[model samples]
Target: NSLAQFVFGFTESGRFGAARQTKNSLVINMSWGVGLGMVLDDKIFRGHNGFAGEFSHISLFANGRLCACGKQGCLETEASGWALTRMVKEKILEGSSSILVEKMNGKGEIQMEDVIKAANNDDVLAIELIAKIGDNIGRGIALLINIFNPELVILGGSLAQTGEYIRLPIKSAINKYSLSLVNNDTQLKLSQLGKRAGIIGACLLVRKRLLSLS
Candidate 1:
């Protein structure tokens, strides 16, 4: 309880606060890569080896893209911001037409922010690419919801700034794949923390460990 209070206290006091009104919550940070954290029964649930929340490496595709984990088809292969950039670059290489192509102007590289900016400007390719990434993300999240059954799922990291662009597909996937009993009660929310959630979480984690040692 003290650990939970401490973690939450720091998080709440920081720039981004809790996105849900429950004791049980799962926070999935999706940026260049994916990371996951959970609070259960009002306490942080770090698995026995202190690596329980490694949600990014969960296999989502068999024979899918190779992940940095030296595995094929991990969730990070298709759902991370890096994944989106990869997808966009692939499309551009294949001679796909889009405003992004003009923006890139032979740069031969695309940042996630570039894609997001194009999407916001209503670039067709950018929107489609983001939607595809969102779909992949939603599929992974559907599994997590079924497994964890948490009351809330908070999405953080740079990609979450796209807001409804990503959220809609995620919701659609959850609605289609997750059981109504679980999906109905699980509220999906964008992290109020934006990109600072990870830093705040790290500080809280250190505090929790020091407290536990004492």
Candidate 2:
């Protein structure tokens, strides 16, 4: 699809410049959700059913929290924005110390933006929770590195806005778990495209599809 293709193209053009500059590169667009997109020989690869990049559903824990997909311990359960909110809510319910308590304003819901805001404000609990999410994401990325050995892993989505607070932990986890030889070469990057990625990708896809039909 163009969404996947545009993401791949944007990453290649913005970061790597030339496709040949890297051995192999993978573009992962993870926001409130997660997905893995690949650029192989400068082309987007969608497996047989066009469902190749369902990285979010990868089973990470055998008996972990339930996922919307009706599976337990899926990567999304631990690493996505929803997961972050869940963690924060759990902590708040436990009476953990956090600025989020007041930030909630009596609302019984926690949003990912609230977590990001709290983390940016140097809230220890927020920072720690985000770090945990990053670590879980890193573990998932490590598996991808082992399997694909791509030269790059680009992170996008609302959570990527937290920058180093999240990236650092993910890098640390990757370094600790991933094979040094393979992990060392892979670069983890935040999306420069930001929120525009989905729009850009969707537009690109439509244009391409129409062009193909012509």
Candidate 3:
């Protein structure tokens, strides 16, 4: 995996961040994309690459899965936006009976949100599909906890809207693989900020930067 094979290099050379300096960072490896961190001295730990706290990759694959980055076995292959959407498309095409199928006007042209809505309404196939994605998400998180060893993990983004269905599996996965010491200090929880998490998190960064200038 590129993440492991180049972890040290990325952490040092800003490979994971667009920033030119090694500032403290906040890495948020969401189910769909990768984010970097920039912290320093008990704060965000921005390595050379100004990317610290990123953990969307842990090689939890089954030895072979197609990734958009052209990687054969990355976490993105299993639980990312790419992965979830792929799964949804396949399930619908498989003739599965789901509200999603109905939403597509009896066709199989489903979108990500459609599946989420169908799942929320208790569609059998939708639930099964979501659970499958949740399982993969959990597996990815387990690898993340074992590697980054963070103290707290908050899951945010569109998928978070799925509610407990996503959290339960992720919690289960982390517990299954994290070392006792890591798990003891770490807590897995959903994002409480709702749709505002992204904007708020970004605003926090801006506020911190402005304060730093003061």
Candidate 4:
């Protein structure tokens, strides 16, 4: 799904959108986990076992919280949609007030979308959570920027919909963590194709594959 998303950014913007003609870019899909897809020199990068772009599991903390991948302190522990939901639930359990408490009604579940909606509606707790997670995610991206120094970094998926609530923190963190000279070359933007990025990229991938076989 993530690799397909990179296809969307690589082709859509580079060919038709404002970032046209770009040949090197990266896509970070912020859903259940932080999914990454890289395009360098106009080609997708699949690592040795085709398991590349697992940006979420890049263990950031030595003694931090445990992640679903059974690792402690992974970036996903703080930055992904699952992380956002987890943080909200933890805060609520600790008596942190937010509209989410009312939305959950003390029994039902609170989802990622609910938090995003709350943030967009100016819920203080939700906004704070997003800012925190965005900062962590940006730290991870900063490492990538310093290394790959791609032309663009496209952020997509559910969490990114919070708009500047998320983007600003990520941008700030990137500035703080990455080298000015390196990050200066990168253009970070939310996916214009929005939620449909993965689906469209999948379609484009299939077409490309079939055409190659022909």
| Candidate whose lDDT is highest | 4
Model 3 RMSD vs true structure: 7.2
Task: Flag the better candidate by TM-score, 1 or 2.
Answer: 2
Tens-place lDDT per residue, model 2, 21-116, is 565676666566666777665566778866577788999877668888888889998888888888898888888999899866587577888899
Cα lDDT of model 3 by residue, 99-205, tens digit:
66565655655666776777788877767766676777766666666666655555655676788877777777767766777677665555555555445545555
In angstroms, give how far residue 151 of model 3 lies from its true place: 3.0
Top-down lDDT ranking: 4, 2, 1, 3
How does model 4 score by TM-score? Answer: 0.90
lDDT, model 4, position 101? 92
RMSD of each: 4.4, 3.0, 7.2, 2.6
Per the 3 Å backbone cut-off, how many clashing residue pairs does candidate 1 have? 0
Which lDDT tens digits does candidate 1 get at residues 119-158? 8888888888888888888888888888888888887777
For model 2, the run of ten residues with the poorest summed lDDT? 11-20
> What digit string (tens of lDDT, one per residue) describes model 4 on residues 70-157?
8899998888888889899999989999999986666888989999999999999999999999999999999999989888888878
TM-score versus the correct structure, for each prediction: 0.85, 0.86, 0.74, 0.90
Cα TM-score of candidate 3: 0.74
Error of 3 at 175 (Å): 2.1
Best by TM-score: 4
